[model samples]
Target: MTADPKSSPLFSFGVPALFVWLWSTGFIGAKYGLPYAEPFTLLLIRMLLTLVLLGVLARLLKARWPGWRGAGHLAVTGLLVHGCYLGGVYYAIQGGMPSGIISLIVGLQPLVTSAVAIMVLNEKVSVRQWLGLVLGLVGVCLVLLEKFGLNDTSGGFPAWTLIWAALSLGGISLGTVYQKRRGTGADLVSGTIIQYMAAASFFAVGAFAFETREVEWALPLVLSMAWLVFGVSIGAILLLMWLIRRGAASQVASLFYLVPPVTALEAFILFDERLGLLAMAGGCLSIAGVAMVVMRPPPVNKQ
Candidate 1:
């Protein structure tokens, strides 16, 4: 008997939605952790723990190791995905850019990814998908408009901070496409172990160069590190790699459009941030666009 595709451990049901929610929480975890440590230092700790955990998991699972060339590619992709992306984000937040503004800037990533995928990966996007991308971006703006209001009162962000955030947008977008093109054959656990190790090295260098490498080890900081390392760097990232390998890059990137709204809702519940009706409507619009982009049409039949 043929097995159901959704039943596969990699493509299990609700994985996409689960990924978005978990990924969004990384920002929250950062907010929690950053108070007790510098950006590079905090990330160095998370990356090191993630590397050790993934390495052990890879060994126990007897996961296949990539060949030398594939290992190189995985490391490069990790530099972009984990190193550049998180480095940019953490540095920006530390530099005093409001998370709301940074998120808004990062919201441009789907459109950027779609264009890059067409050029780099030769992935053709349907007009409907393009429309969906636009609608999703608009919805993100609507949802985040109130947050921007907070930013205005928060004072001006340094130009370099914006640059770092923009680099993060580029990092994740290209990293996804890079993995789809280059890292497809590697087993998840082994590949992820290498990725985290490389990312840890990157952050360690940054910490030594820029930070005091001090951590308070407070309860919230330790808990935040654990959540980010295990919950985000492992679980959400594995799901992301699986999705990118199986889906069109454009389609996969479109899912990021939903992240801001989801993160906003998470903020509401966790931090008691206000959730307005306008934001709800915008969230609905963003979800509608995601559905349009990801839900494939039924296959045509010839008589």
Candidate 2:
């Protein structure tokens, strides 16, 4: 019988690569969409649209729904992974924290996830993996170093905004470990539907409570919404859940190290952003770091 292509090495590597690329575009999408809508309002619309699309998909695919207990677990994951992480990021940026600073703050996810995983999941991290995590963080710092012109302060950096960024970091790091610990074995499609429902409700509340809920609905906003809803919320998120189910939490979190570098490249291409040599070097280090964390050693031959 022919080997299942899903088990191929290419599939393993390709899926993560695709997830990184798609996730990076989220920054680009937010940049395009945020101009036309408040952050909470924009996320509210995106989550609702994602729910509608996923609902239809679940119906067509006859996806299995988790039990109520499983659904509650998924809801918690959603609140942390989608609600806190995305909401915090948007609020921080809206509150005038530079994107580079926010990225660096949130880019600490791998280290945080690894640390939490050790305690929560009792997952073992080799020294090599620890080194990789540290290197990845250093790489992210280098990539974003030029953008750290905190001296300017013309954008009015509120000290409180750092709290939002820190919330984002904590949410994603804890969320990954939580998912690895409690989110396994659920149906990806239906479980993710539950997740989106919870996240949508969170954003909806934020929109009503805080945002004006005014959306300009221009072409750029529309395109950004479409991409974020279909490409990121659906595509990349599903891949993330799949990876979490199949890999260690720390291993999966390492993939996030690539996001800032990839986002920088996307911004450079789409928004005419400058890429310094340090950023290029940092990108290389991030790639190497992730490879170390994710790559497993070959089996030794037994005599």
Write down the lDDT that model 1 would get: 0.88
Pairs of residues clashing in candidate 2: none
Residue by residue across 251-297, what tens digits does model 1's lDDT show? 98988988999999888898899978888888888998887787777
Clashes of each: 0, 0
For each candidate, what TM-score against the reference?
A: 0.95, 0.96
> What are the Cα lDDT values of the candidates?
0.88, 0.90
Q: Which candidate achieves the best lDDT against the true structure? A: 2
TM-score of candidate 1 on Cα atoms, chains taken together:
0.95
Worst 10 residues of 2 by lDDT: 146-155
Give the residue spans of candidate 2 off by over 4 A.
1-4, 147-156
